[model samples]
Target: MKIIIISYQKILFQGNIISIIAPGYCGYFQILKNHAPLISILKNGFLKLELESEKKKIKIKGGFLQVKKNMVIIIL
Candidate 1:
């Protein structure tokens, strides 16, 4: 799935990811390939991304996330 993370001043990340774990308002949640569409409010915490052979973590102050059609977008 494609993932994009953007802040007011820059694009933090844009690439294809195997999976992702984000700090949702209620708690942390994971998104995988072909997952159902969703929209959620994020908390101030870490966002984790899984790549083909590596994993990455991004610190997010707070933001919103939208997932649809295997695409995830986060705006902070």
Candidate 2:
């Protein structure tokens, strides 16, 4: 799946990934390819992604997450 992370300053990340771990309002959630669609609030935490053999992590100030059409759009 593809993941995009955006912040008010700029677009933080855009790439293909196997999974993502982010802080949700209720708790932390992991998103994987072909995961069910969802829209949830985010909390301050790290946004972790798996790209092939690489694992990337970025800090997010908390925002929102939307999953659809095999895409994960994170606003933080």
Q: Best-fitting candidate, measured by TM-score?
A: 1
Lowest-lDDT window of 10 residues in candidate 2?
25-34
Residue pairs whose backbone atoms clash in candidate 1? none
Query: Per-residue CA lDDT of candidate 1, range 3-45, in tens?
Result: 9999999999999999999999999999999999999999999
TM-score of 2: 0.93
* TM-score for each candidate, following the candidate numbering: 0.97, 0.93
Candidate 2 lDDT over residue span 1-76, tens digit each: 9988888889889988999888998888898888888999998888888889999888878899999988999888
Pairs in clash, predicted candidate 2: none
- List ranges where model 2 is wrong by over 4 Å: none
Q: Model 1, clash count?
A: 0
> Which candidate number would show the highest lDDT if scored against the true structure?
1
